[model samples]
Target: MKRFEGKTVLVTGGAQGIGAAMAKAFAAAGAGVVIGDIGDAAGQAVQAEIAALGGESLYLHLDVSSEADWQAAIGLTLEHRGRLDVLVNNAGLGPAPAPIEQCTVQAWDRIMAVNARGVFLGTRHAIAPMRAGGGGSIVNVSSIAALGLGALMEVAYAASKGAVRTLTKVIAAQYAREGIRCNSVHPGPIDGGMLHGVWSDPTKLERRLSRIPMGRLGRMDEVVAAVMFLASDESSYTTGTELTIDGGAAVQ
Candidate 1:
């Protein structure tokens, strides 16, 4: 049987980028997939793509920062699939690079709401259902920024991710005995999508690339594979851990 033949996964911010990749991957692995994102059009497009691939999926309008949206999304998933086997807290915001001193309070709050608070809310709600069902896995998409390995700028983004990192550990420790597993994935300088906007300048892009010992930006599929492992039974023994997929950048 396929690894996830009887599973269901909900991927937040799944309309694009790594979140989209995770949604596709889970469906391909034989899970019923749910794509949650604020971008209705893009989210529907992803749902269509999964359908075309003969995968079962649904798209839900979700603003990760809102408690109502989280409740609704989870409610819909349980209504449709009966049980949620995995939750990917992949929604996040990467503000334009700015020094801490120059960062506005609004920008800081916005980042925290989406990046940090969103994870908290998702985890808070997902746990009860998971426990009732006997088990579940939560794969949180954090960042290399949380490790203090990002550019000198991005203070707010870094702080927000740091919250996600700690929160992952707390959830894992609190719920391990209940069969619920929680882990965080930290990726660095992923190519395309969000990074395209961050590294729009050729010189800046090259400078960023130079920092990675791999001499290139990481691929979305690479990160998706890590998330898939964490989500599957293959990682049954793993929890409360941080998996860094940074192309050796974090080491240097």
Candidate 2:
């Protein structure tokens, strides 16, 4: 499915986890992939893997919270790919669950910087290039916490993701006339290192699984597929919307 043939996609936090999965999937779909992350070794490894799959890719050092890094990433993408067709604001920081009383201001600020502000910077910079190239898609990786459908264990993380959800809608509304589409994905209890603590503890794992109606954690590939759909042309009419990949967790 070479749906992204001739397109170029820039994925922030493409060094590992869901971001890495999305990068590889996009490359397999025929997009020239640009992996933006501070983790040089892992990012380069993902890039190499894409190359091995017979796809074109580039790796760039990016700190999502840094304005300078955002500018450099966007510039590098344009310089290398000549145009940007998709932007996935996937870089995020999830801190250990701490109640509001126990959570420090520094921890809150740090989470907001990466999860919320990072999406802002990426979307802000990607607009011009996309607008110039006849517009593009922006997929913001939010979480079920934004919708008040999670355990609400981390207030700051929930707040940050809520901001992402709102920002995505606003961008979609503001740029629709220009042909730019913005949407968000809300994932719940994905089977990744994000929940290592819960995975290692039997009681915690059982409790977590009990909440999801499907009784299982989501796979990284599931989230990747949702992002791919939102980024692809098949979703031409979709914007300002959110696709939740929570395995019925949100319902229960």
Candidate 3:
């Protein structure tokens, strides 16, 4: 049987980038996938792509920062799939890099709401269903910024991801006996979406690339592979861990 033949997964911010890659990977692994994102059109497009590949999927409108949205999204998943086998808290935002002194209060709040609060709410609601279903895995998409790497100007973004990192560990420690597993994945300089804003300038892009020992940006598939491992039974013994897919940048 396929590894995830009887499983169901929900991936937030799944309309594009690494989240989208994860949705597709889980579906291909034989899981029913629910994709949540604020971009209705893009979300639906992903749903269609999955359908075309003979995968079952649902697209839901989700503003990850909102408690109501989290409740509704989880409800919809349970209603359709009966159980949630995995939850990928992949929804996050990286504001334009600005020094702490120049960052606005509003920007800070917005970043925290989506990057940090969203993970908290998603985890809060997922636990009960997961426990009810016997067990589940949560793979949070944090960033290299959380490790204090190359995030000098992104104070708020870095801090928000730090919250996610700690939150994953706490959840794992609290629920391990109950069969629930939680972990975080950190990627550096991925080639799309979030990285686009930071690497738009050719000079900056090259400069950033120079620091990675691998001498390149990470591919979405590389990160998705790590997430898939954490989500599957293959990682049954793993929890409360941070998996860095940063092309050796973290070592530097």
Candidate 4:
């Protein structure tokens, strides 16, 4: 349907997994895409794939935890696309799962820096260009753990994503008057490199699957579909709300 014709969308962590999925979806639906990620090679690969499909795209190096990188990325997007219609903050890191007792200051800081601070910085910098364009949408990729301990062993991840969820509301409420929409997406157990280090063992995988009501893991495209909705005008009336793509697992 070419839902995003003439619109330029910027996606963080666009190199692979959920972020890559969103980039592909937005480009396929006719949005000019800017794939921002630390994964330079993967980002370029995705950009190339998009171009092959006749989609407009560019891959820019973006380290979400760094303000300098954020500024440079925003500048590059403006220079390349002229204007940005949507911003998706999807970059994050999941440290080796550990209980709060074992959570060192470094681990906590790292998680907060990427999962929480990254979103904060992304929205702050995005507001300027978006407001200049008359308005825009901001979508933060949170996690089901933010809804509350969906299971266990995710203390740090939960704390960080929880901050993301609240930060989203703060942005939504503050910028609603400026024609900007801010929302968060909480997806559960998505299979990919991102989920690899955590659920690599059969025991862990089965243990997680047993709790999900749907008895299956989430797909990258599924999460991307939700993200696209929140990123597009289709979610015109939605803001400060979290769209959970957890196959009912968040509820269980």
Write down the lDDT of every candidate, Cα atoms only: 0.91, 0.93, 0.93, 0.90
Give the poorly placed runs of model 2, Cα more than 4 Å off. Answer: none
Per-model root-mean-square deviation over C-alphas: 1.1, 1.1, 1.1, 1.3
lDDT at residue 86 of model 4 (Cα atoms): 99
TM-score of structure candidate 1: 0.97
The 10 consecutive residues of candidate 4 with the worst lDDT sum are 148-157
> Candidate 1's error at 186, in angstroms?
0.4
Any runs in candidate 1 off by more than 4 Å, and if so which? none
Write candidate 3's Cα lDDT for 160-247 as tens digits. Answer: 9999999999999999999999999999888886777767788988898888999898989999999999999999999999999989
Model 4 per-residue lDDT tens digits across residues 134-234: 99999999988898764474788888999999999999999999999999999888887488665778898999899899998888888988999998898
Candidate 1 colliding pairs = none
Question: Clash pairs of candidate 2?
Answer: none
Which segments of candidate 3 are over 4 A away from where they belong?
A: 150-153
Colliding pairs, model 4: none
Question: Candidate 4: misplaced stretches above 4 Å?
Answer: 197-200
TM-scores, all models, native as reference = 0.97, 0.97, 0.97, 0.96
